[model samples]
Every structure is written in C-alpha cells, then in structure tokens.
Target: MRRTVGAEEGDKEEEEAEAQYHSKDFEWEELRAEVENDPSFCQHLLPFQPTSTSSSSSPQAQSDSDAWKRFHIRHSAGKFFKERRYLLKEFPELASCNENSKVLEVGCGNGSTVLPLLRGNENIIVYACDCSTETVERVKEIIDASNIISIKQRFHPFYCDLSINRFPTWLACNQCRDIYLQSQHKSISDVTMNNIMDSNNLYLLRESGCCNGGVDFITLIFTLSAIPLQTMPVSIKECFSVLKPGGLLLFRDYGLYDMTMLRFELEKRVGFREYMRSDGTRSYFFCLDTVRDLFVGAGFTELELEYCCIKSVNRRNGKSMRRVWVHGKFQKPL
Candidate 1:
C-alpha cells in the first residue's frame, strides 16, 4: 500500500508539471481578477500620476503607463525567470560586466533579471521598471529581505497612476523631485540616480548622459513576445529609440513552436500568426530568420540569433513536449 501511494504521488507531480508545459485557456476578466486578488496587487496602486516629461504628452499617456504597471504587478515573475534562464545561461559577457552600466528593463516584471544579476555583479545600477506596482513592491520586499547591498543598491518602486498629472508620492522620481525642488540649489549630478525608478517614457530621465552617456546593456526578457504581432513594429521602434548608439539589447521569448503556440493553433484551428490570450494579452512565435529580420528592420545590427528547445516527456501516453524559444542579441551602430 505504501508503494502504491508513492506511485500515485509521483503521477500527480508529473501531471502538474505537464499542465504547466501547456497553455491553459482562461478568460481575460477572470485573469485580471486573479491578478487583483494576488498578494502583490497592492503595490500598483499609485497615489498620483506623473506630470509629462516629454513635450508630446497627454493625459492618456499617464493612464496607459498606469495600466501597464497594474498588469505587471499581477504577473508571476518566478515563472518568467524560470523560462528566461535558458536564454541567459550562455551570455557570460553580460554576466561578467561590472563597469558603470545602467540598464533599462521596460517590462521588468517581478525583477526576475535584476535580483540575480545584482547578486552576481554589484557595480551595475539597474533602472528596473514594470507597469505593475505590486510586482515592484514585491521586488523591493525581496531585495530588502536579502540585504543584498550595504547601501541597499537604491531600489525604487513606482505606481504609474496614468490619471493624475502630478507625480505620485510613492514614485521614485517624485521623491528625487521633491528633494531637488526643496533644496533649490543642488546640481543635477548631485541627485541620486537610485532615487527614481527612471521613467524615461514620461521624460523623467534626462536624455543626455542619463544612462552615463548610454547604457552598456538593456535586457527585454519575455516581453516582445507578449506584444501582438501587429503592434510589434511600433514597440520595437520605441525600444530602439530609447537605446543609446552602440548599446546592446538582448531578447528571449517564445518561438514559433512553443507550447503556447501549439495551444493557440489547437484552439483556433487556423494559423492566426498573431494570437491573443484570454486576458487580452497577445503573442507571436518567431523563427530564427523572422526574429533576426525584425530586429534588422528596426535598425539593430544582429549579433546572435538562436532557437532553444526544452523537452519534457509525459509518462501517461509517452508523449513528448518541447518548449520553443528564440534568443537574440543585437547592437545599435556607433
């Protein structure tokens, strides 16, 4: 009887693993609600919205930023990191660098990369951003608990209100602004970069020398694939616009034959090329060529484009599953 019970437990574990290997269908409203209920959800509720930093800003920009943050807080960062490891394992060059590097991670959900990278190399000042306030709070909590740095490496969490023109009290930049305005005499250089989460999209970051003249590297892990195929071009352009000349950009995301792709194909019964999740999320799977070409079109000079597949076997029917992903590294021209 004990042996039988052990076998049953093993089977259950296998099933659970298999379930995660495939995409499960869900409704967008339900998914949103699930995020709301998550413990990390509270971090995203910004007390106010940030005033525009760019000349071409509107009320909607703030709103959009807030919405993105809220969505980010609800996501599972742990799972994101698990999927991300396959792409980062071989990039020793990035892992080793410790110079005056400033990194901007656009959708830095749960700070999957920031935490580990900071642990490995201490010199980098990471400007990690996520649309989710909950996720940001969670990251701060994790960092605080670990006691990673003596001066605490300046981790800042921002709640993108997207509604108010005034910067929220919790905003990292706002904190800096309050001090700068109050002091009325300090040089910009005297301001601590660590104080703000660095919202460049809203023009909070100064264009010249903001990234120490330019960021040494920028990582967009698992985010590009989340954008719908149609909007991908624009998104890529935006990313390109932010990157300094000669700066490096690394991306890892679902490939053409990932589990999610298979599930999308199964549900649609037609090749939709671009698929949307129940939560109003969308994604695209890319072949090596497709990904390389997309980056090239966006004016990025490709360094490496590779496809990786992680295989898992189902014991029940002797079925095998492969999680496909595309990993790429590109650089802007000097």
Candidate 2:
C-alpha cells in the first residue's frame, strides 16, 4: 500500500532538482545583460555625454570630464538620488554638534546629503556644492519641492569645482538663488539684499571678502575617488584650508578589490584599481594605508579608519556580491 523509491531513484530526483536550480541561478547572468540593454534601464545607467567643446582633446582628460558631466545629468534625472540616512548615526561628530555648527558637503549632488542633514538638525547650517550646475539646480529643485520653510533658511547650495584651488573664491562669487526663490513673496529689495546675505551663512565673508575660518565639519562621501589621482593631494589640502581648527572630516568611499572593481574586464581597467564603467563613469578603489597617507599627508590626524566589507545577496539570481568601502574620520589640529 505504501510506495518507496530506491536509493538510486532518490539520488536521481535530487540531482534533477539541483540541476534545475543551477540553471535558474546561471540564467541571472543572461538576464542581467538583457536588463542592462533595456532603454529605461540604460537611461538610468548612462549619464548624458558631454559635447566635444566642453572637454579637452586629451583622451583621458576628456573621458574623466565626460564621466562627471554624465553623472550630473543622471543625478538631475533622479538616478542615484537617495539621502544617506546614516549620517548622524555613524558620525558622532554630526550628532554631537550644537545648533551653531556648520557642515559642508563637498560634491553634494541634488541635496541627497544636505537635505537629510537639514531635516535632521534644524539648528545646523549645511553648505552644499557640486561641480555641475545641473546637479546644483536639481538640489534647488529638491529644496523647493520639499516645501519646508526652515530648509530655505538653513540650506545653502552652490556650484564649485573642488579640484581647483580657488574653490572658495568661486563659491563666494556665485549667488545662491535657492534662498532668493524662497523669499520671493517678500519685497524685492529685502529678498535681494538681506535674505540673500542671511541665507548664505556659509560664506561668512561677503562676495568681496575671502572665505576663511568658518566650517565645523566637512563630508566627502565618495567624492575624492572621482578626482584625477594627481589632483587628489590638492583636493585634500583644500579641505584643510576650509575647515576650522579641530573640525572633523568624515569620508566614505570604495575600498580595494570591491566586487564592482573585480567585475571590470581588462579593457575597462583605466588605471591602478580604477575602472571606467560601460556608461563612461569612472571609479577608483582605495586601500586603508593609502587613504591614511593621503589624509595624514594633508595635515589631518586620523581619528578612525577601517575597511567595511559587506556581502550583498541577490535573492532572485541567487548570486552574492561583495562590497568593500572605507570609512574614516580625520581631524584638523587645534
């Protein structure tokens, strides 16, 4: 009355099931390619390419310039736009700061970091800057769309290229229109003079004056790796120039041999541990020692530095990817 399968039959059934599972798992690789090819997906994946006039003739310089231009376009399009929710939690410096604290988010695309920080702490003034005007415009859009009255008061967005030494001057010269837009309901003169000056708390010195000795915290989230390797030291030194004595520089960026780095083919390898993605965006992986040297070389004392390794699993594809990132806190001496 009972049916019993022989050991050999059971083994055969188990092998068939395992084989079917493996097929599905392997199919994910093919599916990923197809998905990447989709128009909608590509729109999100690829940034807008820069015109020839906008970039230099040198292939490497042009490539890097195009990559950043594309990133700004993609950011404006709402691709890769998400608030970093862990800012206050991970960096105690942000959490402990009082209402008078001033924080600058370098490469703050579309207000992803600034908006959240503003929402989290009303007393703190957040200064955000990006190399791309398009990205800066998007940040203004986000601030306007939020409809939060206090945000207009506390958030300052500007267009600045940190790779250059004269960023402070450039930031001072550019008018922050977001505050003006918010104060449009007021008298034109009031909005033009008082409101503009009030909103631009980051620039303690007016347009005629140089920006010096005001920043309390500076955040470089995945920003330094985008700079050309040769210019990284200059960028770090510039960060030193902006911060007040004892101010903290909080940084998070890709670490060496990350899964994203490992996925690059020989052709995509543009530099040492640096790769250009299919979409033309470039990324560099960093090692802890190298990061320490770069920060220390720029006169920052390391408070904390570590490599964070995380295994992310794709349940649909049954694939696991390793993500490695470096998180650190370096402080300027008092």
Candidate 3:
C-alpha cells in the first residue's frame, strides 16, 4: 500500500514534518561541502559515461513511460497516496488566483499535487496528464473519492505522453468545454475515456475550433526529471507552448547533491547526475544552473530558482539524512 519511492518510511514522514516548518533547514553549500570534502562520494560527482545497456537506444530509454506505467500498476492498491498540502504554501497563487483559472499538471502522480489544489481552490480548473492511462484513471479515482465540492466538473484527467506528444488542441481551444469533464457524474457508464486525449474524438465537444489559447499555469512538481535528459528540451518547449503569456510555471525536483544521489551505486549511473533505480525508472538530479538553462532556453523568464536543503532524522535508526530539492518558478513573457 505505502511505497516510499526513494526514501524510507521514516524519512518520508520526516520530510512531511519538515515541510510544515521551513523550505530550507540548512544551506545547500554546507551539504555540498560535506559531500565533496568526503572522498567516498566522488563517483557521483565524476562525469558520466554511457554503457551499452544504458545507451539512448536501449530498452530502458525507449520504455521510460512503460516503466512508469508498471510502477503505477505495482502500487495501485491499498491507498498510500500522500496529499501534497505544502504546495499551496509554496505556490499561493493557486489558492488565491482568479476564478476559473485553468492549470495543467504534467506527470501528476497519484494525485498528491492534485488533491491539494482542488481542495485549496474550488474555482480553479485542473487538467492533469500522465504517460500512463492507468495512472490517469487512478488519479481520477483518487480525487473523485475525496469529499471536495464540484470536483467532477473541475478535475480533468487525460492520457498523453507529453514527452513524445504535444497536449491535445482542445486544451488550447478557447471556445470548448470538455463535456467529458463537465458531464461526469456518480456513474460514468455512458462516458468512454478512451479518446480523452484526442481533439478529433467524440470525447471533446467544442463550440469553436480556435486553438490559440493556453493555460494560466503549469505545475511541474517533480515531473520533468522522469523524462530522458535528451527529450527534456522538447518537453519543456511543449510546456512553454501551452502556457498563456505571463503564465507561471511552478517547478520542483531532486537537487544535485541530495542524499539520494549519494546513495546510488556507480553502476546505476546512466548519465551525468542521472541514475536508474532497480524498477527501471530513472531520476535526474538538477543543479540551479541546469534548471535555469532548461527553462530560460525554452523562452521562459526565470522568476525564482534555489535549492531546498532539509535535514531529517530517521526514527528507525536514529540516523540523519539530508535531502536536497530544487525549487523554481518561471513565467512566459507577457
């Protein structure tokens, strides 16, 4: 039921506790100093060299989405989804934004980010997408099961691989109402979600064909790193294309010298600052410079970028673990 992706149960709980207090408990420079000064962690800092099994044409690279699909299926049961209540604190605009302001959540896993946004802002409309259809449906199920008001109308889940494909035109179609989202009810017997991601299908009912619009905000909460580094440029460009002028893009992901990065074995290294887990899913750790380049290079104006370093103690072993995460906010030029 409860699967701790990278950290153990104690560390995850500690993180949740730490979030309630501060975004930065210690300086990232301090952690970097401690890590770099130590010789044992040298392998993670060395330049990465690709191996045959880890090549771009390898199965791991080709099936990254498939790997995530299997990940969702593996943890499908018993309800371990943690609602990210802290997101509202980090991005208060979502809680106090204009009514009916549309937001697109890329790689919304298990509704951790969705539930809070839905609960915090009843008037906001969230259109969530993931590479896995199974993950998409599961998010709908998780959020629908919550006791929020009119969520059936505000929460829209669709299947699309944003890494390889662009968002559906209907998402940018100003005159359309996703009947599939608006018409959802207690029983979804009549509605078929098979074509939810296609603008040419019956799933979308439009008033006009104008596709010159974009969402007010896009939340990339730990979403970008799942993708292969090579495809990140196009993926970010796709995100930039779908955001309205002056729209904000919220970002968060693993930071360069985090404890997890140090824990990875040298053999797990697939690319510079990148590693693959036993489950076949890969994680890319970002430094501030890399984060800035990715967003700015995609034509976004960087507003805020920094490292969040938090130290949490593992209750089981009384061991201390320092976690590092990148936090950022970028806006499309008005």
Candidate 4:
C-alpha cells in the first residue's frame, strides 16, 4: 500500500470522528468521582513529593530527551503515525485562517499533526521540530513519501530539544520576544509594535535581520506531557515567546484519571501526576487547574480549556476504557 498524505482512517487509537471531537461522552467530574471512589484507582490519588531530582526513579531532564531519542528510533517504522482528522474540527481556525499562516508544531512526532494542518489549508506553512534526530528524519521521509502539494516548500522539519534550549532565533527575533518578555513601557505604542510583528513585516525582517517575527499558531498536542515536569514552565514560556502577538496555541494532552494514567504501576511514579515508561519517556497527565496556571502564568489569555472525556473499547481485550484528554486554546495578548 502506498503512503499518502492526510488520508483519514479509523486507527485503533485516536480515531478522530466528529462525535469524538465535540461530544462529551462522559462528564469529567463523574469520572473523577468514580475513579476516586474505587480502591483500584486510589494510588494515582496519592500526593508525591520528589525525594531528589537525582534519584534513579526520578527522570532527569538530560536523560529524558535521550529516552525519547531512543523511543523514536525503536518505533520509527511509522506504526505511531496516525493522521488527526478531527483536529480541524477541534480547532477550526487552522482550516479557516488566512493564506500562508505560519504554524509551529512543537514535538512534531511522526508528523501526525503536521499532515492534517497541511491538508486543511493549502497555503499554511508548517515548521515542525522534534528532539530525536531519528524522528526528525523519519517524519521528513514520511512527508516526502506522501503526495501533498508543495511538500518541500510548505513543510520544514528540524531537531530541537526544546525543554533544555531556546528556539532558534529564526522563529522569533530578539525584538519580537523582547516585546513579550520585557517591560511594556516602550517608546512606541502597542499598536505600532503589533503592526511591526505582522506577517508581511515579519518576512521582510527575515530578509534583513537574523530571524522571522513569530508563528501564527503553536500546536502542543500530547507534547508537553513528555517533558520533565520541572521543565514544563520554562518549556511553555519558550513556546509563548515564539508566537506572534495574538497567535493561538492549540493544546491536547493526557488528562488526569485517564485509563492510561491509572494503569501505571506504583513504581512508575516519578513525581506528582508524573510517570516514566520502561523505555524512559515520561508522561504527565494534566488537570484543568494545572493546565491553566502554567499557560496563564506564561502571559497567555486562556480562550478555551476543558477535559475531553470519552469511552473507547479495547479492540483486542473487548473491554470498555475511559479516556480523558485536556483540550485548550490560548492566545498571546495583541
């Protein structure tokens, strides 16, 4: 079978359908009550305090990136690549945005998120990054194998360990990031500042200066959960700096009390709401409050935030599974 770009299919996991996109299959509070009341789920509720950052059980920020690098290498066969068709429904702005809208997909694993963004809007340009060199190269191969229009020009992939390092200056110049990071009391008016960060002016800056102004959208789908919990705030701030004024950040990640989170053994607990897999990659399940404080603290205005609760059936085991995901939209102040 030939691989094609943006072909929607019902994969066992993440089968993005309309009902799955909009409908609340179950109430999050109800699920929380059920999980909290059950003894089997009690361990996940236990509060955890890190004994030490250097503890063997606690995932180190340095090795965490290495673990992901190894993970992509092992699963680089494209098994994990699944198109998120319902993404356009969840965040329609990606499909409806103006021509040549720039999108930065943080931790662009297997190019799953990038493909739909490309298919939704022909004119959208996506710049994706992953820590794993294997993933970076693998996703490039997957997109190259596909038949998307202007694939070369529209899709750009690079390797960046975002948790530990700042984004390349080309994504946002010193001036653009300074506007968001520094004191607002500048010589110029806020209106004039925004106008300068506009897309047309941004490209012009790319020609003259060392960087483009900023991105229109940043997709944080399931990416933030994998970073070391300690580094999450800095990671989010990094994303905030790279977004254009008023640009939206689309986020979806594992949520608290999800079936997956509940399944982790007691030994897997590294920190509060954090767990590590055998292969070394970490997962952090999010609650609305935790999600809000992180982004809002980083200077984004919360536009939409909620728990996406759904019940899915395990095809092989023939058992019902309760799934929870945090969905959110945040925008930088204009």
- For each candidate in turn, the TM-score is 0.59, 0.69, 0.83, 0.88
**Candidate achieving the largest lDDT:** 4
Please say which candidate is ahead in TM-score: 1 or 2.
Answer: 2
Flag regions of model 3 displaced more than 4 Å.
1-19, 56-61, 78-81, 173-212
Model 4, 228-261: lDDT tens digits are 8778999999999898777999998888988778
Model 3: how far residue 256 lies from native, Å: 0.8
TM-score of 3: 0.83
Candidate 2, residues 264-300: lDDT per residue as tens digits?
A: 6645655566656667666777888889999999888
TM-score winner, 1 or 4 = 4
Worst 10 residues of 1 by lDDT: 1-10
Residue 72 lDDT (model 3): 89
Give the runs in model 1 whose Cα sits over 4 Å from its true position: 1-88, 154-212, 265-271, 314-319
Which lDDT tens digits does candidate 1 get at residues 182-285?
Answer: 33334567434522423333244443322233345667776666544545666675556555556788887776645545455333221234444443344566
Candidate 3's residue-wise lDDT over 1-334, tens digit each? Answer: 1111222211223433323335567888888888889999988888777766664546444588988899889878614446676788778889989999999999987888888899999999999999988889889988888989999899999998877887988776423323223322314553344334333533233334455356899999877888988889999988877786678999988898877788888888889998877877888999999999999998889998987766666655777777788889999764
How many collisions between residues are there in candidate 2? 0
Q: What is the C-alpha lDDT of each candidate?
A: 0.51, 0.63, 0.76, 0.80
Q: Which ten residues in a row have the lowest lDDT in candidate 4?
A: 1-10
Model 4 ranges off by over 4 Å: 1-22, 51-59, 180-207
